[model samples]
Target: MKIHLTSVLVDDQAAALHFYTEVLGFLKKHDVPLGEQDRWLTVVSPEEPGGTELLLEPARHPAARTYRDALVEDGIPLAQFTVDDVAAEYERLSALGVRFTQKPLETGPVTTAVLDDTCGNLIQIASRPR
Candidate 1:
């Protein structure tokens, strides 16, 4: 079996869409209206257009809000995205005024950096040595 879709709890879907697409370089795959000012918005990486999608789920549910807040309070990342180079991605994002909680750091064979998603979540960008 393989992964299909995953989600990241977001306080604002519009803002999340902008960051995920315009900044993070993901492409909007699906955006169907779900009523009540909400939508079934999802994004996919350009390199893998048919791959797994990342849903920008609204954090309206009490449990989801609490969970997101708790993770943020503890400085934990809500999701991670693999990149070719953590440092380069960090620099590119930094230039776009993106705020990072942790600079790129090497940990054994992998490198990682954490950044605020501006949608109430900290997301990690990671790279592994080839």
Candidate 2:
């Protein structure tokens, strides 16, 4: 079966939506109420709307809480995005007041950096050699 959906453990789905959409330039695709004050929300890339959807799910469940906590403790990233120019993208986003954890650094044929997604997530942006 094809993988239909993927999800991210967020502390607040609404805030995650804002960060992904407003800051990261994603567009909201689906938002439906799942429970009282709970929602099933997803965001997609504007340039590649059919590429993939990022589920903005809450981490109130025990398993999600543990996973997110462990990731944060280990200082690992929750997700990564491929870019054509890591430094340029980093500077563009930074000028928009985006906070980054690391600046672009070359690692072999790829240059990469990390940014605070503002949703309890570390997002890595990388530019790989062709």
Candidate 3:
């Protein structure tokens, strides 16, 4: 009935953490070491600390790597995050040296922009007229 957690495959968990937290403005919710080199890492939006968590899962699985690579090759975003204003967020992120695959594009009542996560995924930021 409700969503608790979701995941985005990351090539490097540490780098993903930095980008998701320092750049994307998410807060770390969970960080448990799973093995010698991997950890069960997750992050939540600062505005919604108790909301759904996003797992920065390692993309060690071959299938996951292939799937992510294909999506990137096609310039398709692997995940999307809602923001108050896509254009504003795009500007803020761009100032931080983030590379955007697609600039903010308005389509009807919604606006969206796609940016590389730096850890091997294209993430989209979107906003709808409110």
Candidate 4:
């Protein structure tokens, strides 16, 4: 079996799209209008054009808001993305004015950092040990 699609609840799909693509370097894959000011928007990593897609789902549901709020309140990342080098990525992103909650820290065989997504979520960027 293979993974297909996953999602991150976003307060604003448009803003999320801009951040994920223009900033994080993901490519837009699908964008079908779903009515009521919402769309089925998704993005895929440039390195893996046909790989799993990340859906920028709207957090309009009551339960979704509650869950997202709790996660943010606890300083938890809404999603994680693998990078070639955590420190380099962090430096680049920081230079772009991205706010990070956690700086790159080595934990055993992996290094990770958390940054604000600017659309109501904290996202983690990590690098696995070589």
Best by TM-score: 3
TM-score of 2: 0.89
lDDT of 1 by residue, 16-130 (tens): 9999999999999999999889999999999999999999999899888788888888889989999999989999999999999999999989999999999999999999666
What are the per-residue Cα lDDT tens digits for candidate 4 across 61-90?
A: 989878878888888998999999999999
Q: Which stretches of candidate 3 lie over 4 Å from their true place?
A: none
Error of 1 at 49 (Å): 0.5
lDDT for residue 16 in candidate 2, whole number 0-100: 90
Clash pairs of candidate 1? Answer: none
The worst-scoring run of ten residues by lDDT in candidate 2 lies at 66-75
Residue 30, candidate 2: Cα error in Å is 0.5
TM-score of each prediction: 0.96, 0.89, 0.96, 0.96
For model 1, the superposed segments whose C-alpha errors exceed 4 Å read none
Q: Which ten residues in a row have the lowest lDDT in candidate 3?
A: 121-130
Tell me the tens digit of each residue's lDDT in model 2 across 1-130. 7756777878888889888888888899999999798898998888788877888988788787677667766667788888889989998899989988788889998998988887777888988675
Inter-residue clash pairs, candidate 4: none
